[model samples]
Target chain A: MIDIALTEEQRDCLQELINVAMGQASDKLARFLNTFVHLNVPNIELVNFDSLPADFTENYAQQNLSVVSQGFYGNEGIRGESLLIYKVNTLDDVAKILGYEPGEISDNEQLTDISSILTTTFLNGLAELIENQLSYSAPRVVSSATSSLDDHLKQLSFDWDLALKVDISYMVTDYSFDCDMVLLIPGEAVKNIQLVLERILKEY
Target chain B: MDLPQINQFLVKEINVGIIVIDAEAKVKFINQFVLSNTDLATDYQEQSLFNLFPELPEKWLKRKIESVFTLNTPAFTSWEQREYLFKMRHTRPITTENDYMAQNCTLLPMSNNADNQPELLGFIIEDATDVCFYQKQLSQTVEKLEISNRTDSLTKVANRRYWEERLAIEFERAKRHNQPLSLIMFDLDKFKNINDTFGHVAGDTVLIEVAQNVAQNLRQSDLLGRYGGEEFAIILPETDAEGALVLAERIRLGLAMHQIKVDEGTVIATLSLGVICICDDYSQYEEMITRADMALYQSKRDGRNRTTLYQA
Candidate 1:
């Protein structure tokens, strides 16, 4: 492969940056859910197309309604895919956090009404951060039904040798409340991010 | 060009479904005016009588086809010979795509062959249902006769001879224009066994149905003809190898998905496709075919029912 691997220190720096970035995403999601939101980055991987995790639907499945959004970043300079996932049941806990009576069916319409609003707010916030950092076009939201991450990779026209991957996961825990987010980064953008992180750490 | 004028012409000016079957009761040719008027729910351009109208008393039609092929006699089925008088049905084959007038059909005998004998049994259909009146009659017997020489006897599409004649011209045109031209040479997977197991009649049915389905998927400008027994060729005028590969995949998928009902069991058919794009300076069409044939063999080797494009 044409890409350079990240050193341990560089990897740590990149993870720290993503931790901060996802914190921003968590705040927006919490505000939309009207609950205290917790997002933690557990692990990140640098891999190839063949190494992607299976159970595609299960990854996004949740007790409540789920919303998944996809967008591209770093076309020329840094390139990869970003995905955001939200579980509706988790949003139920969010409703309780934002000062609504818990477990009230009649008032659930008020809770359900936030799906579009919250999805827009969180996805847009995340996209803006990536766009500013990468200097690329605005993220185009892909439909969850027809768009598979693998299909997206296959459609890419990049020189595969230069590609790198950065896969990250986010989890929300509120004692009794829970939700998750899985972020899939295309192969090329991982290398770019690693370089940027190294430069930032050296300057510090 | 305008919808209103076109609508007016289709309604008032065309009586297109007057078809005449010969004494052997086979469709010789359909008129232009009638062809436009009648919509066959399926693409039947250059199709023979049995292939297009398969359910049209095939047992009876086969005898007639044999007689026409053997006796060299013109068979005429007069307008009065119908078993029953039925209401004309208006149909648009691609209902999802466009709305068109329904066809009013009338069958008759038209003869055009080499020996000055009526070599063909024609079906003249009129488009009279929507318009409510006969507009004009178009007899393309002579034109169809010239075309028939280039057509396969069973599928009623371009025959090997036609492909040989036409591909050379298209090759020259592509070279002169520096345009992309692609060819897909394919054959039915396991066709010999199908003929061996099921009678030859069933095999013929499979060929006819497969050809019709492929014809339906092709662009109007694309040239489709049976290259030989169990093999077909499609010439895509302005397509490169990549585009041809995609088209071959589509054809393979379409055939695999379409289940042709024969009798008790449904026949699942597969195809191996070989695609080759003609280079700008291509001189001999055979080279393209050879490349395509190699790709087709590769597909079969790779596991049939797939598409393989020629590397060079």
Candidate 2:
């Protein structure tokens, strides 16, 4: 595989900043839930863009997963999407935590609402912690129904040669509440991200 | 009563349900919008959220909530995907169409202080039933309008304009795949004479019945359209010259056998059909249709109820 264009140091720095932002975001969530939240440092990968959906749920492909996505625009051609994926089986737990009795109805409106809130907080946190200001569109759920992420992959409108994949798993530590969030940065944004990281390194 | 008190007031009165879950997976707080709106009678404090909203998917909810609880990243749910996180009936002030309430839900991670002290899951649920209802109505109307525009008013068959577009598409596809394509233009023989002899009513009956007869003989993949003023056209994909000839003769025979009874007497109507197979020499789709129309003219000139093929 042609390695990602970023140097090892640049990649490590990017991961560190991403983790910082994730921590900041989890702090907001922890206060919201009146509980402690746990976060894992994202597992970063550089892969061909075609392999995104499959790479997202390689471990839990058998279970039904919900995908919510939001697009963002950044400075100096830094642009990409943040996708959130989680199993559908935990939707009941989500309804209860949200004080909803969604019942047996499938494809309900509340599903989008939950994804929107989580994606927004996440993208914003990741943006702010990296010391970059970014504009975001409202979050949307592109796939659900089946466990396969192909529907999600097929519907993606944009084109990209390569992507910087950030995979982070979060849970409440005690409960079985687990989810994976993936951030996709395109080949075009690699230079911009490197510039931002370098500037941070020099200033501090 | 500082900012937090005022914020609590807004959460209760803002017309959106607010539910907060603590780190222990217990209900921290549910605002008035949620408490008054739902059918729950018991106090929600310290209650397991799962017990209250039992239908909520256990796997998805736990994963999302705990993610926010730990990762500090917020998540969202739109009505289009999950419908309603709760089983509340639609309460929007308008016509009732939806069975369950439509809601846009937000899952927020909140920390008590600047530091990640005691964290809670903040949920904001908004009623979206009316919006969803109007959107559905709009798409349905658009679909109906589209269907009507493409259909012939009298026979409920596809109109000439729609057929022409399909013809061009079929031509390109046939060329790309190196498959044989055929066209047939059929006309009710001496239709003007029928109108003069039996009046316009009989002519109309013959036209409708002729279209039905020709359509019944053709395959499902074939396209049969009213080709303007007593003429109809059929496009057959992947069909050779012989297949087109057999179907054209079958339709001519079928129409001649069926008789229409008007106010005066029984009228026997026959159709003259012209068939042409698209050859490698032809570049434009119009050439194929024009040749079929010419062959139709030949059928009419030689004898009334016969089928003719275009000759080189």
lDDT by residue (B1-312, candidate 2, tens digit) is: 899999877886888888888876798888877777778865878988889899788766776676555555556676666667888765764576888778888777676642363367888788888878888899899899999998888777789999999999999999999999999998887788889998988878777877777678878899999989898899999998899999999888887888887877888888888999989999999999999989999998998789999988
Show model 2 residue runs off by greater than 4 Å: A1-122, A130-138, A141-204, B1-5, B92-94, B113-118, B197-202, B262-266
lDDT (CA) for every model shown?
0.57, 0.75
lDDT tens string, model 2, A1-204?
Answer: 323577777777777777777777677666655557787767777777667656665766678777777777865677887777777787656654444555633444455545555566666676666655455555776667643567666666665556766676656644556566666666667667778878777777
Given the true complex, what DockQ would model 2 score? Answer: 0.21
What does the lDDT come to for candidate 1? 0.57
lDDT of 1 by residue, A1-204 (tens): 545566889767656665565566567555434456665463555544444434434555433333333334433355544443444444445444434454432223333223222333333344344443221221233323434545654564453432223333323345344433344454466566656666678788
Best by lDDT: 2
Model 1: per-residue Cα lDDT over B170-207, one tens digit each: 88898988899999999999999888777788889899
State residue A2's C-alpha deviation in candidate 1, in Å: 89
DockQ, per model, reads 0.00, 0.21
B66, model 2: CA deviation in Å?
3.2
Per-residue lDDT value at B213 in model 2: 70
Q: What CAPRI grade goes to candidate 2?
A: incorrect
